[model samples]
Target chain A: MHTLTDAALVGVVLASFLALGTSRLTSCIRATAIQGWLLALLSVAIHEWPPTGHTFFIAAVSLVMKGILIPILLERAIRQASVRREVEPFIGYASSLVLGGILVVTAFGIAGRLPLPHQTSSTLLVPTALSTLMIGLLLLVSRTKALNQVVGYLVAENGIFIFGMSLTREVPLLIEAGILLDVFVGVFVMGIVMYQINQEFDRLDTRNLNLLKD
Target chain B: MLRLLVLAPAAAGALAFLLRANAHRLALLVAVALLHAGLVLGTWTALPPADLDGHLALDALGQLFLTLLSVLFVPVSAYACAYLSHDTGRPNRTFVGCLLFFLSAMTLVTLSQSLGLLWVAVEATTLASAPLIYHHRSPRALEATWKYLVICSVGIALALLGTFFLAMAASDPRSGATPLLLPELVLLARAHALSIPWLRGGFVLLLIGYGTKMGLAPLHTWLPDAHSEAPSPASALLSGALLNCAFLGILRVLHVCVAADQAAFAQDLLVVLGLGSMGVAAAFILKQPDYKRMLAYSSVEHMGILALGVGLGGAGVFGALFHAVNHSLTKALLFLAAGNLLLAYQSKSVSDVTGALRRLPLTGVLFLAGFFAITGTPPFGMFLSEFTILSVAATHGRYLVATLYVGFLAMVFIGMGNIVLRMVQGDAPAPAASGHGPPSSHAPSPAAASRESWFLTAPPCCLAAAALLLGVWMPPGVHAALDRAVAAVAG
Candidate 1:
């Protein structure tokens, strides 16, 4: 179980790096979706064998919402918006990948110093979660396309979910459901707004969204 | 009963989306607003039982904010009726539906006792109000909505992480799981059962998260754009009710911090952010071109003061609560009146509007008075609250903070005075051709512009009267409630 959880956590980190390295918007979305699936797996693997109904329910919701529903929403947004590449990202993909690597190392360093009250199934969980969160924020700021930013947001949420898996017992199932529901609705709202941006601005580039300055 | 306050508006909102006629939707909006307000009033007389196994309950702090939200929605609903009536071009279904959902979400924010639940409710507000900000459907409004949505969602996502961290902080290997309930966490903190580093880190994240929603400086990038671009009634609700709900979120965390003896740590951060917001507002307000944007910056400024007041942590907390009430009434008044001016001028530019007093007498007077009230001029409730905060700073010998507080307030007053005085005092501008300004399909006819409907004028009048009444006489009931709320936080 520990080894499986470690592999899933590492997979989540690799998926985030893949998201950063790719300029193709669909590829980026797919990477995040993979990261989401890995997180859902971690949610279950962090628990003992034959996970309880509540654990299964949470893992199922995370798998369906994070891995499946949100990615589909983004893909449709991409098809409608008709933009494929991230095209002239504020920070180039190579540099973003380098920054992503640095973020992972930094996450390990920071996680070492932090204390947790309860034991975790794997030591990699905290660093992986932190790295994913930082990479997501890096993608969010470095990308020019609004769709890419949404992808970044999803990655960051995935990172948070990994962190949350450790606290599965402490947090009530109802609150977890509410949190998942909010993320779904938030992404749904963003997809609708992206459609409007395409209709109004004729492009999804956030650089064009600069009209409302000081 | 607590559940009803949230669910009623949510159900009404769904019904609003289905209702075809604009008149029926507007009537339904007014009815729901009144109903929500009636329920909130009932809570003041007899506090409701906690629902969801104590996850949802109204404490003094929540009750104060809930009441404020309920009261503000009444006038805003009336104003929206009048405001939307003139513009029939766009469908009102989304606008009406979203407004009710916004109400429901805000009600939930006030009632939520679980940190996780509060985080969800606050995030829900961001999603619900995003569409409302895009109601104009102009490119700029679209820009504002996108910025509001993306920035707030990311900020809220951090808050979710913070909530998880807080749960971790409360967790104990010796004991079983600890639910993220506020009262339980406070008890744990008091017992020293929580991890301090985790608690501190979690508080900071929650502060930044909710502070983003509350329009605190540095994190307040989305506020001015959304407030300036959104329709008047929506802006009023956003400024008046929504910011307070976010502040309530922070106060809840701060409540736990106080119990943990981490008050100074949290309060120090509040003071820094509060001062930074004021300075940002002062700089922007001094040269603002758009009147609505200027009002938006002033909100940033007031949000700063509220933060600073709570950071001061004694009588200052009381002042912050009082100021929250005053700021809501006054800001709502200003935004609603600004809407009236927008109708008359068909522009938000300070240069485009002149002699508003002559164009719309009641709205102009209210607008001018609201400026004074918000600037902390004498005989307004804001003045008293601002004075209390200032005096608290002085007595604490925090002369630098006190000086900066007065200086920022003075700078804001002068900056707003220049723009507002110019707009109100000059001869009326010739009604420009409607196409000259931003493309607003809802621009009223010249006749409608000149004639101020009782619908639009009366709401601001009532708000202004409330501000004035509170300034002079704090009803004993409200005073007691404010004291109880202050105790909840400052103790």
Candidate 2:
């Protein structure tokens, strides 16, 4: 169970890298959805067999929303806006890959310094989670497309969701569900904004959103 | 009572969404605002019980913010009614609904007692106000909304991570898991030694996260655009009520920090960020071309003052609470007045708008007065609060901070005055000469049309008056509430 959880966490990190390297927007979204599903799978793997209560509930919802629902919303937005498939990132893919590598090293270094309250058998979980978070932020900053930013946001949210799994017993079911609902609504709203941006600008590149200023 | 306070606006928001008649929708907005205010005020005599297993409660701090939100909403809602009447180009169903929903989310932010619940409420507020900011449906409004949503969503997501860290900090393996409740965390901080590194890390992340939402400096890049582009009434609420909700999140985290004996770290960060915000606002406000953007920068400056006051941690905290109310009233008044100016001048640029006093007498006067009130002039509540914060800083021998505080305040005053004075004083430029085109130039001033209806003018006048009244005399009940709230935060 512990090795499986570690492998799943590694899979999550790999998915983030996949997202970082991909120029195709749809493939990036796919990587994030796969990352989300890996997160859901880890919960079940960690708890071992018939997870119940908050664990099962969080896993089920994470699987559906992060895995299935959010990607569907983003894909629909992609179609509706007819946005270009290529990311046309502000930071080139090679450099982003290098940055992601540095972030992963830093995540491990920082994770080693912090003491966890409850020890987990999977040593890679904390570092992987932090790395995922940094990559998400990287994606947000380095991407020009609005939909890609939403993808970055979901990836960042997935990082936090993984972090929360450590405290699954402490955080209430209501709070966890509320967090999921907030993210779902957040993406849903972003999708709507993307549609509006397309209607107004005839393009989805947020680089052109520089109209308002001092 | 708690349910009434939160759910009333929500129900009205849904109702406003379905109502086809604009008049009925406006009436319902005013009615719900009054009812929500009444419920909040009714609980003043006696506190309401915490619902949702202690997840929701009106603590002293909550009461202070709840009162601010309710009080500010009344006038802003009234202003919205008249403001909506002029712009017949777009249907206001989403605009009105989003405003009410914004109010509901802010109410929950004040009421939420648990960190997790508070995160949810704050995130909900970001979602709710995005539509309100985009009410104009122009490309500019769309840009503002998209920025507001993506940036705020990212910021609030960091806040969730901070929340998780906070929970982790409190949890001890030997004791099993502790619930992520503010009061409980405070108790844990007092009784058991918490993991200090995690606690400190949590506070830092939470500050950055919530600071972004609260429009603190360095993180406040999205604020001026969002506030300037949104409809004036929506800007009023965003400035008046929504920022306070974000501040509430930080105050809760500060509460736990105070209990954990990690306050020095938190306070130092607050002071630095607070001063940083003030300096940033001062820099931007200087010769700012747009009047509404000027007001938005002013909001950032005042948020800095709030953080600085609380960080100073004495009469400074009390003054911070007082300053929060004063800022809300005066800032909302100024934004609403700016809204009217937007209508009359048909533009937000200072160069394009001159002699506001000549064109729209009442709004112009209120706008000028509001500038004074916001700049901490005497006879206004901001004056008293700013003085209190400064005096406390001086007495505590933080002379350098005190000097910088005064220096920033002075710079901001001159900066804002340079623009606002230019706005209200000169002769009205011929509308065509002002470059707004022939149709708007020949059109009768919106101020002239809105002047007859007290709905447009009265609400802002009353809000400005309330701000002035509080300065001259802080009501005993309000005074007590501020003291209790300060104590709650100061621990």
Candidate 3:
């Protein structure tokens, strides 16, 4: 079980890198979907065999919503917007990959110094979560397309979910469900707004969204 | 009873989405608003028991915010009814439904007794209000909605991590307490059973996360745009009610910090952010071109003042609580009046509308009064609260904070005075003098546009009177409630 959890954690990190290096919007969306599936697997792998109903419920919901449902929504958005490549990223793909690599190193260094109250099954959990979070933030700031930014937000959310699931054992089932519901609705709302933007501006680049300012 | 306060509106909001007639939807919105207000008032006399095993309860602090939210909704709903009648370019089904859901979510924020539940409720407010901000369907409205949704969602994601850290801090083997329950965590923290490093880290993340929603500087990029672009009634609720709900989240975290003897560290960070927000607001207000945007910045400034007062502690906390009430009343009044001006003149530019007093007498007077009240001028409730914070700062010998506080207040007053006086005192433009502007898609007909209805003017008039009354006298019950709320934090 411990070895499986460690492999899933590593898979999460590699998926984030794939997302950062890709310029095709569809490829970026696929990378996030793969990360979501890995997160769902980690949810079950971190627990004992024949996991309890609570853990099983969370895993099933996340797998279906994050891995399957949200990807369909993003594909529809891009299909309607009719724009593919990331055209003009603020930071080029090559440099973003390098920065993502540096972020992983820093995450390991910081995780080594921090103290946790409880022992986890794997030592790699905290560092992997931290690295994923940093890379998500990097994608958010370096990308110009609205669709890319939404992908960045999902990556960041998945990172937080890993940290919460591993670190705290006492979180209630209801609160976890509420958190998942909020993220689903948040993405749904953002997709609708992206469609409207595509209709009004005839493009998905957020650079054109510069009308109101001080 | 507490469940009723939250669930009733949510169910009604769903029902509203299915209704087709505009009048029936409007009636449902106003009916829910009145019913929520009455339920809240009943709590003042007979407080409800904690429901869901203490996850939902109304403490002194919760009661204060819930009351403020309920009271403010009444006038805003009435104003929306009047305002929507004049401009009928689009269907308002989504607008009405989202407003009720927004109310339900904010009420949950007030009543939530566990940290995890509080985070859920606050995030829900962001999702609910996104559609409200995009009601106009214009390109600019869509831009503001997108910014509001993305920035707030990312900031809130960080807060979720912070909540986990706090749970980790509370999970000591010796304590055996539930992780995120407020009462249990506060008791554990006071006993020094929690980890200090984890507690401090969690508090900082929570501040940034919730502070982003609260419109603190450096994270307030989406506030002005969302506020100015949304229709007037939604703007009023966003400024008056929604911001306070975010502040309540921070205050809940601050309550736990106080019990852990970490108040000094938390207070210092709040004061810096508070002062920085004020400085940013002062700079932008000095040459603001749009009046609605000017009011939006003023909300930022008042939020800063609330943060500063709470950061000062003791008497300052009391002042901050009082200021929260005054700011809500005055800001809502100003936004509604601004809505009137937008309808009459068909512009938000400061240079576009002049001699408002001659054109629309009632709305013009209320606008001027709201300006004075919001700027902390005399005989307004804000003056009393601002003075309380200033005196406490001086007595504590924090001369730098005190000087900066006064300086920002003066700059805001000057900036607003110039723009407002010009708009209110000059002669009416030739086109406006005849009670009309150029016919546009959204603007009302020439005859109905300029004539101020009783529905439009009465709500703001009532708000202005409430602000004035609060300035002069505090009823005994309210005074006691304020003191209890202050003790809940200062202890």
Q: What is every candidate's alpha-carbon RMSD to the true fold? A: 1.2, 1.9, 1.3
TM-score of chain A of 3: 0.98
Those runs of model 3 whose alpha carbons end farther than 4 Å from true positions after fitting are: B174-176, B432-439
Give lDDT per model, in order.
0.92, 0.88, 0.91
Q: Count the backbone clashes (under 3 Å) in each candidate.
A: 0, 0, 0
Kindly list the per-residue Cα lDDT of model 1 for residues B433-477, writing each as its tens digit.
Answer: 534755555557667787999998999999999999998988999
The regions of model 1 sitting more than 4 angstroms off are B432-435, B438-440
- Which clashing pairs does model 1 show? none
Docking quality tier of model 2: medium
- In model 3, what are the clashing residue pairs, if there are any? none
For A1-214, candidate 2 gives per-residue lDDT tens digits of 8878988999999999998998888888899899879978987887646777778888899899989998998888888887656557889999999999999999999999888987765778788889999999999999999888998988888888888777636477788899999999989988999998888888898978988876
Where does the lowest 10-residue lDDT sum fall in candidate 1 chain B? Answer: B433-442
By lDDT rank, best first, the candidates go 1, 3, 2
What is the C-alpha DockQ of each candidate? 0.78, 0.78, 0.78
Q: lDDT tens string, model 2, B294-359?
A: 999999999999999999987998999899999999999999899888776667889888888887
